[model samples]
Target: MRSIWNGAVSFGLISIPIKLVNATENHSVAFRQIHIEDGSRIRHRKVCEVEDREVTTAEIGRAYEDADGTMIPITDEDLASLPIPTARTIEIVAFVPAYRIDPLQMDAAYYLAANGVPAAKPYTLLREALRRSHKVAVAKFALRGRERLGMLRVVDDVIVMHGLLWPDEIRAPDGVAPEAGVTVRSKELDLADVLMETLGEVDLADLHDDYREAVEELVAAKASGGEAPSAPVADRTGRKVIDLMSALENSVRQARVARGEAGSADVGADADADVKPLRRTAARKRSEAASEPPPSRKKPARKTAAKTTAAGGAAKKTATKTVAKKAASEAKKSAPRRRASA
Candidate 1:
């Protein structure tokens, strides 16, 4: 990782030499605009409306419009003469409870690492102190020609500085009217809870970028002599929305059936197909044993011999036995298992 800024973090008379490294990285694929006809790259030009033509970089000037609608041009020297203070250091002003800050105020995060010289003692002290107090240090620093407000907190034994939004930047919840006189049935709420329970454990690793996968698949298909796929058609059925209570009940029923908690007619059909041959073969063996004289008690091995013959007669007998035993054990445990949905 490259350091975005290099400066010291100051508090009182103590200053720690540190460098700021960006904590987040984006893996998104990038593309540029091109001429569709000839597949030629496209470029943007800087044009001046006053001159009605493209202008060079050096010929451009910065100006601000005043209340009187007059454009006032400012030079680099004039901007430098302004009373704005430039402090490159991250100065901690005060410590506040971390929970008091809204998550939406957080803009960017950067890791602070000590430059060359060991900062182990001070770093550890600051990190442990913040962790114990559950507070974050509000700090100010200069970056990209402007002073910014930031929060300094310890995460995973390292100090990180996160940029914050100004108070005015946060939008107020005004005009967001609440639902009045709306009633919810108790049974509907209970059914919603049951549906949530049927969803088993969440594994973030299982989530993937389906769009990227689809793009790759399309590319492969095109390479294999297939035409490029068309864009997806939007769903415009215009069907009426179902009642919330009924929807919740149906969702609960579906979840239960998916988790094998409730057996459906389809499940019964599958179960019957799986056990039909086993039942028929077992009955036939029993009938044959009954036709023959009952094995004498002196030969107890006859029972074992009958069982072995019955097992061998079934197709994939060993595999079926193993699978049946495993299923039985899993059913006895009664814990929910997550399976990928088709």
Candidate 2:
């Protein structure tokens, strides 16, 4: 790959000549502006306001606009005269733990390649030192026209540099979090933990850009003069969830189903409600009563009485399991009742 910048890394008295190349690339579909009526391509022209005519790149110059709306012309010669030591060198200012660098300050990333055969020793040495120390080098370098802060760390066998915004550039997250009045229940937190565990970790390499793929497919269909491909519409029930506990429980079950752990049972009729959230509402009590088997009126025969005893034992066992599952929910609701009584 072609390098964007050529510079030497200044580490104390040692200097390693290196080339900087971008670490990431954009792969997105581009669209051009066109005249809808004439089906003609649209192009923009640059014109000077004073001259009122089109201008070439050679005629253009850089300028700084003041807050008072005055334009100050800045020539290339004027910038070149500036005394900046980091103009062509990546100067290592300090070494710091990787966690010390705020993620919010992270910007563009680049790989530092050894510029020449002689520079390989120092490059490898720096990479090994950074790896053994478990730290990153804070650096200052000039690229394009401005000086930037960077973090140097080892990625595999290569030394990579990540551009970072200055601490002052990061905005304070004032009024960004949720209101203080909102509260999360312990039951809700438990359900959220289960949901997290169900989803678990994912391999980033296994993921792909679905939107980009869809756009590419659309473009291909248009180019071939064929009807655009259709995708199956997702079933979206326009339901607004009012209960946080119910939502979290449902989310966990859905995540488990998506991971294909419970086979088809999760989406089937006989799926177990082992982790069901129990709410102490009037509607819930009514629903629980409705689900229970009603009492039989007729007296039982001797043989039937034995069967009835066995059924009673089984019912007691099931009730015990239910109580155990609802223990936390019951404790939470009973606390208020006890307080009221006291």
Candidate 3:
């Protein structure tokens, strides 16, 4: 949560004092080099190629190679004093629609928080203004001794500043003509649109870094002297050669099923219908049995026999109920005329 930089955001005469906090964090597994045989730590050295000796930090200087193969050395102070001005202020030059900028131009993002109560007003104003206009402000500032171009946009009522890649830094795709054209049939386009319709809404929370998780697991296994885990096998069977019209129909059906507009039986009618209910019944029984307390193994046969005998006795009693009721009524009628035999 530490602020990477503290500066003011300037737009015309308004300036908002704010601190920049890094928006992202590295979650990759880190490792150190070690001797495989002895498990000894390995250290790197800074060696000078010409002298054939190790050099200290003080001996190192920045150098640029000239076109004539001459080495031009420069000190840190000289590089700092270069013609490029390192402005501490994020000076917004222009505002443009957010969608107009390509996502690839974004290098890094940071959170901009107002430093004090006096700065909060301008910060809020800029954020609300950006949201209302549906645009982001293109700005420039200096960080880590380099002049950086950035985009300021509102995210969840907070100003999010993103460092942008310079136009020169982004290379155009090579070996291809910019004016290349390809023809698409109407049927193919229609099918493509149907396929796109099957896709659900984008949910950012559903996305996860599977590769990073696998790498971390591998590292942990190796550290415990275990073999590396196997890579996941991909299923490549049942590849289809699509007929445009048929594919479009199938895609529409799938989309309807996904949205619960069509029943399961209506969607996959030809597939084994008996298998689904049977599987569901088996799963339900298994779940019920799993929830119940396990029967005691001790004297299990005796317990079963006792339960059976009790059920038989109850059945016999119900069968003789009419005779027993008639006998009881006769006894009551006779006993009313006699005195108690005290």
Candidate 4:
């Protein structure tokens, strides 16, 4: 990458020579204006409105208009001779905790590198110091003829300079935030927390510009003489916007569903209450079936077939024996007492 600015970082009496390279870039496609009638490129010309004639680049000059509409031309040479201390050096104004700097103030970033081998030591020292202390250096520098406020910090072991918006440049967020006295419910907050929990951790790598991709697709289709893609359907469902509490609750419920949890905000509130009993009854049945002994695992019964047969046989044998003895005695008695005495 080409270095855009050559400057030095100044703090106290020390100056570390550094070269600045733009940290970010745009990947957007550029479109040129064309004539719809002839499909030809459209060209614009510089013209003098007062003279009604064409003007060249060399004839153009920067000018300031007075309150009375008097135009006073300012020469490029006049503006170039002004004293700008920030032009050659980025002067450190203060070293403050990184968190103290608002992200809204950041505008553009640049990668800082030592201009030469000799400047590397001091650059490394400052980078390490910022990394260890977790601090950002508020600095001032001039770029493109404008003096700019900036923050210098270490990003991924490399020192970076970010141009910051001026105090007047940042608008108060009072108009952007919710109106005062518009209270939020604890229930709503709880549901929002649940939604956040369901959302899980953020990974910026997963985020992308779908609009850019769609634009490229549209261009490709048009270039190939194919049918143009249809526009995306706008969501007119004000369900979320109209009811914050309900929306948060639904979001939480949907996230739970995604995570395979039991929840349905759209369903009745008593739905859970009704579901629990069925779950319990099913669980109880399972437990009862588990507790009951298996037929194969049971001990033999007291009235089993073999035991019943043996008992009946024993009773019959005793009865028959008794009857036979009684009959013998009776016959003896009937036959004669004399025979028994003999």
**Residue-level error in angstroms, candidate 4, position 232:** 5.5
Tens digits of per-residue lDDT, candidate 3, 274-304, equal 2121122344455556668888787988899
Name the regions of candidate 1 deviating beyond 4 angstroms.
48-63, 68-86, 216-225, 229-241, 256-342
How far off is residue 178 in model 1, in Å? 4.2
Ranking of all predicted structures according to lDDT, beginning with the best and ending with the worst: 2, 4, 3, 1
Best by TM-score: 2
Q: In model 3, which runs have C-alpha deviations exceeding 4 angstroms?
A: 32-43, 82-85, 174-181, 225-228, 235-342
Report clashes for each candidate as comma-separated counts. Answer: 0, 0, 0, 0
Ten contiguous residues minimizing lDDT sum, candidate 4: 271-280
TM-score of each: 0.63, 0.77, 0.63, 0.70
CA lDDT of each prediction against the hidden true structure:
0.74, 0.87, 0.79, 0.80
Question: What does candidate 1's lDDT look like per residue over 1-342, in tens digits?
Answer: 789888778866777778899999866556689999998999899998888899999998888899998999987666656564335578888999988889989988999988765666666777788899899999888776567889999989899999998878999988687767877654445556556767777789989887777787777787798887777896635323356655555555556677787666634342112211112234445555565876678566888888888877775777889999999999866655433231
In model 1, what are the clashing residue pairs, if there are any?
none
Candidate 1 displacement at residue 193 in angstroms:
2.5
Could you list the CA RMSD of all candidates, in the order they appear? 27.2, 19.6, 25.8, 18.7
Candidate 3, 163: how far from true, in Å?
1.4
Q: Choose the strongest candidate by lDDT.
A: 2
